[model samples]
Target chain A: MEHPGEGTRNGGSFVVSCESVSFSYPGSGRPALSDVSFELRPGEYVGVVGPNGGGKSTLVRLLNGLLKPDSGRVLVSGRDPATEPFEVRKHLGILFQDPENGLVAPFVEDDVAFGLENLGVPRKEMRDRVAGAIRAVGLEGFERREPDTLSGGEKQRVALAGLLAVEPDILVLDEPTSMLDAAGRREVLAYLETLRAEKTVLHVTHHLEELVRSDRILVLNGGELVADKTPERFLSDADLLRENRLVLPVVQRLALEIGLSPARLRTPETLAEAILAKTESGTRAG
Target chain B: MRLELRDVRYVYAPGTPFEVEALRGVSLVVEPGEVLGIVGGTGSGKSTLVQHMNLLLTPTGGEVLVDGVDATTLKKSELRRRVGLVFQFPESALFAPTVEEDVAFAPRQLGLDEEEVQERVLESLRALEAGELAARSPFALSGGEKRRAAIAGVLAMKPEVLVLDEPTAGLDPATREDLLALILGLRNAGISVVLVSHDLDEVAEVADRVCALQEGRVRAIGTPAEVFYREPAQAPATVRVASLLRESKPEIGAPVRFAETLDALRALQGA
Candidate 1:
């Protein structure tokens, strides 16, 4: 993955920044996040991935100041989320991994309208925003339906609608598809591609294959930002990832193992090229 | 000995408007010392199929046999000793104060003596390469380490059959591979392993037999090579590789997973 925040102009900078951010929940010696740092531009789609307990979830919470960093700083929209959290939250939207956690309203439309109402938007304007959000998430007809009746995938879409209703400048999600089946995961990902066009997106997941479309990838290991590369390079770095007990996508690893040209290594595509290249070379020695 | 299922069927919300079949008329056999892979998209019954292997769920219409004994008829304690089930994120199941305690809980629960429990706990941790973590609080361990500790917990029971339900479902690439290798090692050690996953690449790497479940029914069953492309389709990579080989020479019979060498691919392509 191309390292995000690199090679961009430094002027009028980062939407979010973390300087050695470390966090520990109360009464526990272990920290959920430790010594992490990164920056995001206005509309960049960044994928955060790592082994379990590498602080992926914690990183997501830090973005919104839900859990303040115990050691360092987390700034959202150029303001410290730890201090001016209300100000920071106003500009950013976050969708947690669990849709059940976000859907507090009895009805889908009421749920979508919760955030706008909380922000003190005028009642008349809130209705318009709720309608727009529901339509955006492809749930126009289900607005009045009880959330309990929705499938896990639909519930997640409703959660996304809730975030979109806020009309924040950026969106962050944490494994929203974990509870869904394969098809559900696909729908969520497909939706994200469109959403990315309108605002910055940071999707936190451990599944590297699912992150192929992300503009940049931030890999965490032991709560540290270890490898920040473009999705292509990051997945292709088999040796480096192995040292940290991470798996690169199978296709990329097979390609590198079989001696395919590094140039042929692209997400999903590199997989085929690698296998084909090796087969033609007839060197099954590895 | 083999773990076999005979005419297994399961239903959800029975006798209600939303009643649905999760698995149906599934008959299968898994040989000891073999790694059997189960693949299917979501709601295709993959999860339901795996839950049966460990007796986590009772089949409404079938019998699960381990070593020719019906699992459904076994006592709860007996079933726990025969099959160890690991969910996707095993760490979510951890709750002990220290790694040693977590790993020992299951065996200790079985009423093993302290010496026996401690010995098995240490051996299991060593097998997972986590023996040094004895005193550390499990919550303090890293992500990968926590997963290993969970596996160790299951291993302490000395289950003859270990079932991992989507073991690497949402893990980083490196961590996924590390766990896969460990699973492969367990199978090689003569433990019957059943791996349920959607990632065809992973199933290809470790499974001796691969079965696909589609909509509460068994859709396909065979060796990885046989099922990779012969009947139901596999992942895009496996499918492409199989297609190329079949086009070059039709005699390759089916796609072979374990031997994914370049020479094999070239040979399949009539080079």
Candidate 2:
């Protein structure tokens, strides 16, 4: 029913669209999500963060069609996920924060191959895809080992290998580094950065420091979209950010709080250029 | 002393194929009024090392002495009365449906009377400022609220020492700063606190004594300033500025640990 070669793009368009969506788990009076709307084009990396459980995960699940919105519509590749759930799942790959829950194969190679095999792919083709995925995650000669034997980063790599083997156009990660130690988080995050090409990524996390590298950030508070802007613009709003529970990388926070404009947020050289660019954009808009 | 670990070592799956030694020969003591911070990259054995102080992890090769009692010999029943360990997202550890019940878990586990447990729960809720949410479903509270509820569960036990593992991991900047402020208040009341985290700057800011671990060994240990006080050879941008001018009175610029502004660094140059 599925293969790496199949695609949904008719003439190239957005991979996801969330319109006025709100969700609430069973028996919970408060809505987990509130009036949210956004469009994710292909190959765009967007980081979603908010106070813990402010509907980051719920919203991402809506993007790929994992959780249907209670009232609003969530479309995947121009199709309502609720109407075509199976088809929607085929085009997107998900990687949760915990590696233990998503991966099932005993051996590294077997685990990666598990996803491909589900599609009933030919054995030779599945083998090739598995190798390519493992190589992408930078794990060589780790095909036969059990997951427990691998280190935290390595196991995540294997889980990623499994996700990548499916050849999805978009990847959604749910705090893949939350359980890892410092070095392991760096390794996984660095690896994800390299995978940014040709794959739309929606990283759900509250770690403000981790969002600096993202192209854009969406901040949620009590199921409300409080801020939607570039990481620099988001961080520059020093007073506004204080109301939420998220923290920024220290130096960045200080730079922003000290009157550095969004454009002047990077290093001094970039800061100067950013200041210039901001003036230009502001003037152009004016 | 509130807590002490003279020499503690922990090995995971001893004598097996997965015989990975976690903590190799560690020693430290938290005085009655000290806030000790532990910092390390993942697998540096910080978690394994902290668990020993509260007897969460029985020392496999050494001794853990808490409040003059060697944890190596005390039963868990006896140890629960003295030391309390609050883990990351302790809300996940909440089994009771309601907030009030969850806070009363530890006290009830100690076989306290119902009235005493109720009183402890009330006091704990008041201390964490979640007194208003006691009857509500803990699962339904805000993220910060849930975390506070989890801490209240431990506080109800009324232990002398509190050990938290990455207490502010998923929280936003504002919530994290607020939560840490409350914990600092608890420390002021003489609760020896041991905080284990990966953020060096955070530990540098609040910890009286900071310990950095690497590859199953303690790399550096001393007062927070002594351990991370140097211009942080591998420090972030702010720390580099502070370290660059350590010779001058050094009024400011210490990365996440403190103020990171050009005012002090520039002031130093002018002076």
Docking class of 2: acceptable
Candidate 1 lDDT over residue span A22-125, tens digit each: 88877666677778878887678888877777788778777777878889887776777777877878888888765666789978999998888879899889
Off by over 4 Å in 1: A1-14, A24-35, A50-54, A83-168, A175-185, A231-247, A263-286, B231-233, B248-253, B258-261, B266-270
Error of 1 at B214 (Å): 0.7
**Scoring model 1 with DockQ, what do you get?**
0.28
lDDT of 2 by residue, A1-286 (tens): 0112123444456477677889998788889999887766687798888776688767767766667789988777777877787677667778865565666877899999987887878989998999999987767777876776554446667888898899877788877666565555667778788878678888887666667788878777788877778876777676667676556665555445544454335433343344344445655776
In candidate 1, how many Å is residue B39 off? 1.0
Each model's lDDT comes to: 0.74, 0.72
